[model samples]
Target: MKLTKEERIRLTYQIGDIIEQKCRRCYYNRSDDASFSINICAKCPTGQTLRQLGRYFDTEPRSRGGKTGNMPDGLTPARVRELNDQGIPDKEISIMFERSPSYVGKVKNRWRKHRVMARAESGAEEVK
Candidate 1:
């Protein structure tokens, strides 16, 4: 599962592109100067992704103030998958559970990885 340097760079750029697109849709304000600030809503998908990817700096002031530091106690991986299966987008699901969208995305990603691993194991069994 280890990625080569070039693969890692490519993945990073792709993620950045996705984040940028989401930010643009969310009406994030970007400044031209180096000392300028990029103002984004705290609950925005772009903000969440940037924070998760470690591209967000602590010095930047958020438009929506700060994180409330409240964790969704009852949200589990199964619950997330159920919501997603029911046609709920990750952003809406996160809002419903009072969590960051990146958290929901991570949960979904984990489930996907689990399913992929399970399928691989089942295929191996079939080959045997």
Candidate 2:
């Protein structure tokens, strides 16, 4: 299908963004062409377009071009405890643990509520 002038311009900008992101976060450096190369195609022997290259890599954070960074590598129990001990905020810790920051934040919030409830119950017992 033929693309209109506007479509072509949009497509070009989209492709350029993909290329830049890929270059920034490329995992495999099989060849120099795969990374740090100004022109992705010139390095690729298969003649794949920038769009195709985006598929080979993982997605980045907040990327607009339908791509994202690599899958998160969930947090471990030991690491979670370590983060708690360090007094690291749940959201920041979650990112380090490769889990959703929101999940960590929710867990922290729940713990806070539980502590408050326990304290209230204890206070009532003292009054009685």
Candidate 3:
């Protein structure tokens, strides 16, 4: 996953192309579905991902200008996933995060939900 500087620059340009060509229509068009409705670009998964990538290239972090010093782990769902990927148990993650284990479980669900949302997919896969 590590990329050279030139690769990063190329990737950023590619993402710009995708947003301009593929994701632009979704941003400007209206839709009956709440998930894809107009003005939902703020919540667009592609935009979210691009913004995250931009952060890596920025010299300074942008302050969200929200209330500060909240949550032990900054309430990042990705951190939860990172711990999970390390095969850490939910209970341990919860204790480290100073949140309830059930809350940790819910974060996991939300993480998966956003992932599915990003794909614009429907119809759950059936598992036997």
Candidate 4:
């Protein structure tokens, strides 16, 4: 199921258009219960949030003035998913993903709890 180059370009342009339009509201505002594609959090474009996110990106070395480090990876939720899917250890994932190990641990913990809740809600009992 590989996409041709043209398909990849088209999909990328479409995604860019949606992001440029700030389509977050549309996703959340939809009335139907069908799940919408997950995206960047609603609080995007905020300096405070972006600053908090500095730990995630492999940007530049942090100065004494408290700037983001030179972590080019620059943390994104997609990267989190990818690392988790690859079964990478949290410590290694933290380094490779340019994030704190504790932060990675917390994300994994939260995701685990959420999955458990979903399974329970769907009437699936875990086998001991």
Best by TM-score: 3
Q: What lDDT tens digits, residue by residue, belong to model 4 across residues 40-111?
A: 555555323434443334345556743433333544344555566798767887777666767667655654
Q: Where's the lowest-lDDT run of ten residues in candidate 2?
A: 119-128
What residue pairs are clashing in model 2?
A: 59-68, 59-69, 60-68, 60-69
Q: Which ten residues in a row have the lowest lDDT in candidate 3?
A: 119-128
Q: Is candidate 2 or candidate 4 better by TM-score?
A: 2
* Ranking of models by TM-score: 3, 1, 2, 4
1-128 per-residue lDDT for model 2 (tens digits): 45567866777787777667665445444444445565444555333667464453434344465333333454433344557679887788877766787866654455355553344334432110
In candidate 1, what are the lDDT values of residues 1-128, reduced to their tens digit?
45567866876887668656565445544433332235556767777766665542233555784454344675655555567689998899888887676767765565466674344334432110
Q: Give lDDT for model 1.
A: 0.59
Q: TM-score of each candidate?
A: 0.30, 0.27, 0.31, 0.25
- Per-residue C-alpha lDDT of model 3 across residues 1-128, encoded as one tens digit per residue: 45678988887897777666556566444443333222325567766766776666665556885654445645555555567689998888888868777766765575566674223234343111
The TM-score that candidate 1 achieves is: 0.30
Cα error, candidate 2, residue 59 (Å):
27
Candidate 1, after superposition: displacement of residue 14 in Å?
48
Count of clashing pairs, candidate 3: 0
lDDT of 1 at 61: 50
Q: Comparing 1 and 2 by lDDT, which wins?
A: 1
Cα error, residue 109 of model 4, in Å, equals 0.5
